[model samples]
Target: MATQNLIPLLIILVSAILACVEAQTSDQTSWAKRNETEKEVITTLQFYFHDVVSGPNPTAIRIAQAASTNASSYLFGALWMIDDPLTVGPGPSSKLIGRARGLYGSVGQTDWGLIMALSYVFTDGIYDGSSFSLLGFNPVMKSGREMAVVGGTGLFRLARGYAIANTYQANANGDAIVGYNVTIVTYV
Candidate 1:
């Protein structure tokens, strides 16, 4: 009689534990499904990037370089830390929208290629306080160069996209005005 009673109690305990585990598993699955089913939004933006490598108030400054950097035609192993301005137009005095803050290094031996890791930190309009990260290779001498938008924060959370850059103007001092077109996808 006592064994029978204990068996019922054991069975009830096992069932309760199983139920708890199933509930937890189901809750996690539902959360993932919800995110997966959410709609995605694609947004495109155009802006100008001013990379001021010269003058008194330079935005980009050379931080490090290998000994052979100057001798190499491609500037291999040269790295620069940048806080370049992003604006509405190609001119330096254009209305500021954001900043491209990060670093780029010459990683190519045969070409003028730079490995860029930047954060597009916005400070105006609807995107203020939001920021997206970019990482890719930029061929400086090329007419049109593209980079990947890896991720973001704030309004741009979980963002993925691409950015195209074209040199609008450049001078012998290495200061440049570059135009950018970016397309991004984010969860709605």
Candidate 2:
């Protein structure tokens, strides 16, 4: 009877030891695989987009005339100049690295709300293919509006990220200056 009891105990002990060994081996294999994978790079890039919006073009007027009053409709585009806050000016600055094209429209009263799509082209910096594009709505009277990064090329190929836009300045004539802070992640 004592022998029978010892046999069961011995079997249990051997099984436990084998399980522990297998677990350790799996852990080591998983760690090795992680080391072989490429590391992800995280970076924050700051830039400003100063837009000088005036009035709607003929196309803008046509759309508004079909939908609502002209005062509530606007279609505009601007050349974004990338610059630091302290040295914000027209044309291009030494810090100027890229330009963005934006198309915006207002559907509410006197351009109270706007929907926009933007295409950013970068000639300098670590961005791939010299550019990345994004499309989303411009939240009216709201700060820190977020937009999705659709696609990119070069270093930004298969890129995925988000951008925050804030209005830096607005004039009575409807011209405004906006700031953009974009954060991106990619594998190197």
Candidate 3:
């Protein structure tokens, strides 16, 4: 009777040990910390985003108006072409690099919340395009606003960065020509 009980106990002990060994091995294989000597790459990118809202038909407009006041929420889609000449206006050889699409929720007369997605396509790079998301509070009446670059694709697999956006121009209809200064720190 004693030997029979001991046999069951022995089996249980062996099984527990094997299970622990498997778990630890798998955990080690899944994640590894970076070495101290591996330095991160930082890049500064500048671009202009042309948002047209002055024509009889425009790309951006107020989708909803505020219930009590003149404030309105807008949904806009714009293509941010790469201005190779570093000029604010459209150029001849300007290539399409990305698109900025988002909803602008008006909180105040000049204050708005932005939920935007940026998709970038590298025409002459290792891989095509990678996308990322942005959440920010933009004061259209102010000089600039800083937004968070939540995440992105391709070479920007684990991308995280910040963007400084300034209003370069606005027409009578309140359409915007914006400038972006982005500092990206990412690991591929």
Give me the candidate number with maximum TM-score: 1
User: Each prediction's TM-score against the native?
Assistant: 0.84, 0.59, 0.66
2 or 3: which has the higher TM-score?
3
RMSD vs true structure, all candidates: 3.2, 9.2, 5.5
Cα error, candidate 3, residue 84 (Å): 17
Residue pairs with backbone overlap in model 1: none
Which segments of candidate 1 are over 4 A away from where they belong? 1-28
Model 3 residue 16 lDDT score: 100
Best by lDDT: 1
Question: If both were scored by lDDT, which would come out higher, candidate 2 or candidate 3?
Answer: 2
10 residues in a row with least lDDT, candidate 2: 78-87
Where does candidate 2 clash, by residue pair?
128-155
Residue 88 miss distance in model 1 (angstroms): 0.4
**Candidate 3 regions with alpha-carbon error over 4 angstroms:** 2-7, 10-14, 33-39, 69-96, 109-128
How big is the RMSD of model 3? 5.5
Q: In candidate 3, what are the lDDT values of residues 34-132, reduced to their tens digit?
A: 434445766666766666655675545555543544423332222222211122344424555555555455444334444444443333333346555
Clashing pairs in 3: none
For 65-155, candidate 1 gives per-residue lDDT tens digits of 9999999988899999999999999876899999999999999999878999999999999999999999999999998799999999988
